[model samples]
Target: MVSKKVTVKNPTGLHLRPAGILCNEAMKYQSQITFVYDGGMANAKSVLSVLGACVKCGNEIELTCEGVDEQEALDHLVAAIDSGLGE
Candidate 1:
């Protein structure tokens, strides 16, 4: 398992569109991906779950992945978040 802690930089946070992007990127891997925010955890592969986590700008979240492709998954997802979900 691998994990990355990131502060959300997007002004809008992890809303529907960014959640969808995260989910899509997550789906490309076999790793089990999860994001934890404010003590709430959500599967990264589910847009609704991510959105429901209520992560907002400047909020810190932990992205974790466990499986064969954990490193790649973590790298991609973290990069996505670090990029403000390409806002």
Candidate 2:
């Protein structure tokens, strides 16, 4: 498993659209992926779960991936977030 913290830089935070982008990115990998914010954790592949995380702009989130392609999954997800999900 691998984990890294990334701040949400999108002005609107992890709203529906960006969260959907994240979910789409996560679905490209076989690894199990999750996002941790505050004391809550949400499945990265689920838009509803991500929205439930209540993340806002500037929030720090911990992304974790586990399974065969953990490293690649982590890298992609982190890149997605860092790129503002192409906002």
Candidate 3:
């Protein structure tokens, strides 16, 4: 398992489109990926789960993954968040 705290940079945070991107990326890996916001954990592969978390900009979220591509998957998600989800 790998975990990293990522700060959401997108102004609107992970909204519908970016959430789709996140879910799509998460699906590429076989890892069981989850994003933790506050005290709750949401499945990264679900767009609804992500939006429901309300991860606004400047919010720190912990991304965790368990499986073969855990590290890589975490890295990409971190990068995506850092990229402002292409605001």
Candidate closest to the true structure, highest lDDT: 2
Model 1 lDDT tens row, 1-87: 999898999899989998898899999999999988897899999988998998989999999999999999999889988998879
Using lDDT as the yardstick, the better of models 1 and 2 is 2
The alpha-carbon lDDT assigned to residue 38 of candidate 3 equals: 85
Instruction: Indicate the TM-score of model 3.
Output: 0.93
lDDT of 2 by residue, 11-78 (tens): 99999999899999999999999978997899999999999998999999999999999999999889
Candidate 1 yields a Cα-based lDDT of: 0.92
In terms of lDDT, which candidate is stronger, 1 or 3? 1
Q: Candidate order by TM-score, highest to lowest?
A: 2, 1, 3
For model 1, what is the error of residue 60's alpha carbon versus the real structure, in angstroms, after optimal superposition? 0.6
34 Cα displacement, candidate 3 (Å): 0.3
lDDT of 3 at 63: 92
Q: In candidate 3, what residue range of length 10 has the lowest lDDT sum?
A: 78-87
TM-score of each: 0.96, 0.97, 0.93
Worst 10 residues of 1 by lDDT: 77-86
Best by TM-score: 2
